[model samples]
Target: MKLLKERIMRDGKCFEGGILKVDSFINHQMDPILMKSIAVEFVRRFASTDINKIITIEASGIAPAIMTGYLLELPVVFAKKKKPVTMENMLTTTVYSFTKNRNYDICVSKDFLRKGDHVLFIDDFLANGNAAKGIIDLVNQAGATLAGMGFIIEKAFQHGGEYLRNAGVRVESLAIIDSLDNCEIKIR
Candidate 1:
């Protein structure tokens, strides 16, 4: 987590409107070593939880989730933003993308997510908790138990972290940005 915070300070780009672009390393173009380190940290953080499957939204969350799943030796399932034609008996939910500024119908196959599954949700970022809420809905629809949620970066100023925590969700964020006001990155 310390490594992540330092990397964010060095390479993360701060834009107006509370946007922190970490594409240089974290999301778009990835650093495998750093990602491995992050996966290790996540494994350590949630070692005690009973997790059978790892869930993440497609696109950015895939890398970290895969790494974490590999380390944990657990199956990883990513919810597709666009439901494929072949996908059947799927659990679907709507999620608003903070970055894209649009709603996406995210879904997963019922074969992948099912009742009695203890799942851990992983994602690239958490700002408004919309995606997280969507994941929760999908998990609930499947009758699966959401064990925890992991995030690479969390904008604390947005209060998503507070909302999830207050709702009794175990949320872990490696780098928490206290503020991204006036194109400045402040880490908490």
Candidate 2:
């Protein structure tokens, strides 16, 4: 987690509208080694949980979720933003992306996620937490138990993490940023 925080400080960019761009090493062009470490940390944090599957929303969350699932020996299921024609009887949820300033209908096939599954939701960033909330809604709709939620970076100022925790969900974030004011990122 220390390394991750350091990396964020070194390479992360602060933009207007409270955005922290980490594409250099995270969202866009990924760092395998760093991702591996993140996966390891997630696994370590949830080692005691009975995690049957890993769930993440498509685009950025895939990398860390797959890595964690691979390390945990579990199947990784990602919610697709665009529904394919082949996908039938899909479980769907609507999520609003704060950064994108829009809503997306994310779906996953019923075959991948099922009842009696202990799921761990993973994501690259937790801004408004709508994406993670949508994933949790899918898990709930499927009657799956949400074991926990993991994040590579969390914007503490947004209070999404607190919202989930207040709702009795176990949330873990590697790097928590307090603010992005004046083109500077402050870690909590």
Candidate 3:
């Protein structure tokens, strides 16, 4: 976690108030070594759980999720933000983005999940729980069990974590910030 905290302090930028941009490391251009370490830690954190598949959303979440899946030796599945017309036999879910402050849809193929499989959801941030809800919906539609939710950095000031935890979803975050102000990130 020290590595992540330090990386945030060094490279993260604040756009307005709540959004902390991590372009130098995690979100945009990823440090593969850092990502691998994070993925190893994720494996360590959820080693006991039976994780058959690693699921996440497109754009930002794909890198970490795929890395985690690689470390765990499991298959990785990502929800597509834009549904391709050529893609068939898929289950689609719509989720709102609290970061961009809009609604968008993400798609996943139906053939990925089995009724008894355990899925671990991964994402870069959990701001308002909209993305999490969409992934959870996909899990339900496939009749697969939700094993857990993993995040690299979370906005603790937001209610997303609380909402997901209250709903009986196990959420794990590597680094949680209690607050952010004047381009400064504070950890709880």
Candidate 4:
């Protein structure tokens, strides 16, 4: 975790709207060694649990999810941002994104999750916790067990982390950014 915090200080980019762009090594052009290290860290964090699946949102979360899923030997499922007009599911819910400033629907195939299966949610960032909530809702609809949510790097300066924690969710973040002053990382 110290390694991740140091790397974020060195390479993370702070943009407008409190978004930290980690495109240099995460979110865009990825560093495999760093990613594998993250997987190892996550494995260490959840070693005692019976995690049957890894669920994450698309784009940035894909890399970490894949690595962790491979490490855990579980199938990784990403919730699609847009549900096809023709897609069919008796169960569906909507989540509003504060970052994008819009509301969108996310769907999970009914076949992926089964009752009592533990699923660990993984994502790149936790700005407002909308994505995490969305995934939790889908898991509930399927009657599956909610294991925990894992974040690669969290901006603790924001309320996303607290929101989920307050809702009684087990949240694990590799690096917590206490501040991003003048684009420099401050770890907490």
Candidate 4 lDDT at 170 equals 89
By summed lDDT, which 10 consecutive residues of candidate 2 come out lowest? 95-104
How would you encode candidate 4's per-residue C-alpha lDDT over 1-188 as one tens digit per residue?
98788888788878765678789898889998999999889989988777899988777898999999998889998888877677676346688887777888878778776787799998888867888888888989899988898898888887789999999988999998887766566778
Best by lDDT: 1
Report how far residue 95 has shifted in candidate 3, in Å: 0.6
List, residue by residue over 81-150, the lDDT tens digit for candidate 3: 9988899988888888775778898888888866898999999998788899998998899899999999
lDDT of each: 0.93, 0.92, 0.88, 0.85
Candidate 1 has its poorest 10 consecutive residues by lDDT at 95-104
Our tally of clashes for model 1 stands at 0
* lDDT at position 146, candidate 1: 96
Q: Cα deviation in Å at residue 52, candidate 4?
A: 0.8
The estimated TM-scores of all candidates read 0.98, 0.98, 0.95, 0.92
